[model samples]
Target: MKQSEIIKRLSDKELKKQVFLSQGLLLIVGVGLSFIFFDTFADWNSIMGWKPKQILFYGVIPGLGIVLLDIFIMRIFPEKHYDDGGINKRIFKNQSIGFIFVLSSLVAISEELLFRGVLQSVFGYLIASILFAVVHFRYFTKPVLLLSIFSISFLIGYLFEVTNNLYVTIAFHFTVDFVLGLIIRFKL
Candidate 1:
């Protein structure tokens, strides 16, 4: 389909719904892929040597650190780092902050599971992080943001490599998304 055709058929609300649903679908696909390849859900934690409780401490810690790095970059180049290239128009035009929060959590968890947990675990950090950055091609024009994304991807991947805990990475991803979602919602 042409860009114009897609734009015409998908209003902002419709696009948001599709994106939200697609993210959920990605989670299922990621898990399926993991199971098919590894055949051992139990090994998820063993990969990083992590426990459930470690997620609470390590996830948020790394997430918060990334957020601070984001803030620092965005503050210096607000237009470059903060702009979404009309993504907010497709999502949040009609939705409430609560809805955005829910979506953000879903996106974070799903993305972490797929990227850090599955892809990184299978392919290693360098390749997985590259794939993660490539997927966020929207940030390409904004060099600082693109670099930040790649860096964050590596950090999350590194955390997973060291801790071997999906929950920890999920926690980090969720925290970053939640706070950043709020900030963007409020334009803070």
Candidate 2:
């Protein structure tokens, strides 16, 4: 499809649902590819290491936690969610500060380890960052947004590089996200 056509499809609720489903399918494809190419879905860990709890807590949960917290905060302080520049239009843009903090911590810990720690270190930062940003492409379109994604990915990479401890980056990520969450929550 042409770019405009693809964009139009994305705007359609049904198409958007399909896109979300396709993303899930793509993640399965990725896991399948990893198993085929690397011989282990765990990337050398036990096969069961790739299970839901590990992936969810390590990745999706923490980030989502902060996001939800932000939403709760926004219920009280609506202005907290608004970008003065009005650029943020992601689903969680109206989230509360508490929600953002929890989500940030989650993203920092899980995303850093997943992207920078696992993917970047194993493959390369450029590739991993691109993939990371791509997975989140629904949240933004501007070049600046992409740049921001890359910047955050690099910062996470730096944390991993400096300490070689996934938890280090996780901690840093958690702290940053926690702070952002709080800022959004209380409007402080």
Name the candidate that leads on TM-score: 1
Candidate 2, residue 107: CA error in Å?
2.4
Q: Candidate 2 lDDT, tens digit per residue, 71-141?
A: 56446555533332232233234566655655555455456555655576568757876787777664354
**RMSD per model, one decimal:** 3.0, 8.6
**Candidate 1, which segments miss by more than 4 Å at Cα?**
1-10, 45-53, 93-97
How far does residue 73 in candidate 2 sit from its true spot (Å)?
Answer: 22
- 29-75: candidate 1 lDDT, tens digit per residue: 78888887686656664655546668867888777877787778767
Whole-structure CA lDDT of model 1: 0.76
Error of 2 at 53 (Å): 28
